[model samples]
Target: MCSGIEHGSCRVSDDGRLVWAHVVLGPEEDWQECRVVLDARDGRELARLPLDGAASGSHHMSHPDGLHMGLCVGMGQDGILLHWARRDGEELTGRDLDESSDRILMDVHPGHPGFLTVEHHGADLTLHALDGTVLAEGVPEPSDEEDPPRWDHSCGFVDADTVIASTVESDEDPDRPLHWMLDARTLRVRDAVVYPTGRVRGHVRPLGDGTWLTYDDGSGTLDRWTVATASA
Candidate 1:
């Protein structure tokens, strides 16, 4: 069910039949290997894939047509990796991200021709097409002088063109919050908001219609925000 590895990623199949988890093994002294575990209906291990080298990040994404699944992998300093499989656990393929960048992967958008958003040094955000083409890139402005923010984690897409990204001060101040509404196509800041409290460490996803949900580790709270129908 759970590998209990810190800083790993997990995802359930779109059909709700299988659960896939990629856990990092070995200590920092050794080159960590990513262990991909597939669970059956009863939460039993069906198959295991030991992927050599470090896994920068991993998550589940619905393939085109929503009929299959994709296991996205981020090999730090190497490149992006993708493992695709059918719902029945048959027919699988693995591929690299196509783009080359030292920037940290923020999240992958699961839609037609899936794309990825990565945060480069200096809080610059870069958007890449599924084929590894550079779509757009931009540097985000810090929230305030006292609380200069850094783009740390993000949710892929809130809609066809918008992504909700969580920014935080480098000094690790919980009372200062920096959130941004970025254009997925342009990688530009469309709007921004400050939470006034709490620290966010993950992507913000849409709850249903217009509301988004994100985690605040400082106060152990899940903060929800309603998307403004119109930009200010």
Candidate 2:
């Protein structure tokens, strides 16, 4: 019986057995928050932990194992606070990843022990371990097409060896939207993914099963794409 909260934001666990929601404490203006872990089967409260000193968070993403998670307090270039979380049955604990306050909670790599974030205003994308270890980091080369292509705020792992990264479209070059396939380990530009329908997506979700899903907003449909090999 959860009640009396101004708002609640939830995300289903990767295993599909539980749900995690950030239950905001009243008068969100005061900057208090709680993370509630609930059972998916019956919506039972498995655990709840209070977050101190966090005014608000943009979104929450669960680790593929369903035992850990990361959340960004603010979104975009305004993002400053990112938190790492873990739980054991009815017990949950969380803390800030680093004191630096420079992280954007982009997406968690499916089946990997780390998550992804854009650093220095998308100048580089980095992979981080749950405890905040920089696993890998890379920046795209200056686009030969655009004078200087900027990394879009959206990106995610296509597989263990590849990452589907994006470049935002500009009013001057709206038709130049691109999905770059970056070598996961080196973060080097490998190739461009020719979206079957030529639609640009804001996000790409890596399904643990060697495939990923892309949504076409124009047609309101979802298309699953296979992770491409460097040769293919």
Candidate 3:
């Protein structure tokens, strides 16, 4: 196993050939850090990318090409920064996609040249081009309750054209987190995604294709889902 890896910050490339994570150096109190890329199968070291004095959060998304990535860095009460760098550890850059402190790097579009970000505890989402252009911003419509549902931390791309997002599970509707199907470019609500009884409750993992994976916290069971009908 690779040493000194920040487990929560690890992510695999879309092609499944490489794995990368934030590497903590020296003692735990030192907090000095770098990013290490490794071959997924054999755990061979590929490269070490520098943090350059920036603090990274637990989340990051790698480019589909496996050569570049966006890291959640500069985390603070003001906001988080999207730090960009290549596998070779060169040409580092950072972008403040949104000013919200809760903002995080979501999934990168598998086929398209954009990525997704959520802020304000999932009240809002933004689609950004690879060059940091704001392609679109989407906010969930408030429910009748005084406080809106806030379950979108698991949001991600379902396909190039579709996005999967969720609302916070309501106390009145326990075990039933409503998932929405959205238009990728416009962020328009298309429909609700309904699953069978075998469905799970954890984060949704989109596999680039039309399928996704979910897990049940209570049972520790995992399930893969696909549409069953034209409307689904």
* Top lDDT model: 2
Q: List the global CA lDDT of all models.
A: 0.56, 0.68, 0.67
Q: What's the CA RMSD of model 1 in angstroms?
A: 6.2
Q: Between candidates 2 and 3, name the one with more favorable lDDT.
A: 2
Q: List the residue pairs that clash in candidate 2.
A: none
**TM, every model:** 0.60, 0.73, 0.72
Per-residue CA lDDT of model 2 for 1-232, tens digit only, reads 2333334468887878878887765563464467878889999988888865433345787777667876666633334668777787568988787757476877766556667888646678887777888888867656567456667777777766677777754323656546677777667778766655554555566664566676767678877777442222
Tens digits of per-residue lDDT, candidate 3, 3-104, equal: 333243777877787776766665665655677777899998877755544353456777775667777754444456566566544333344444434567
Residue 208 local lDDT, model 1: 28
| lDDT of candidate 1 over 150-211, digit per residue (tens) | 66655456656666665646335545445677776787887765443433455576532446
Off by over 4 Å in 1: 1-10, 21-39, 42-50, 55-58, 67-90, 98-100, 103-105, 108-113, 120-122, 142-149, 170-177, 194-209, 214-221, 229-232
Specify the highest-TM-score model's number. Answer: 2
In terms of lDDT, model 2 sits at 0.68
Ranking by lDDT: 2, 3, 1
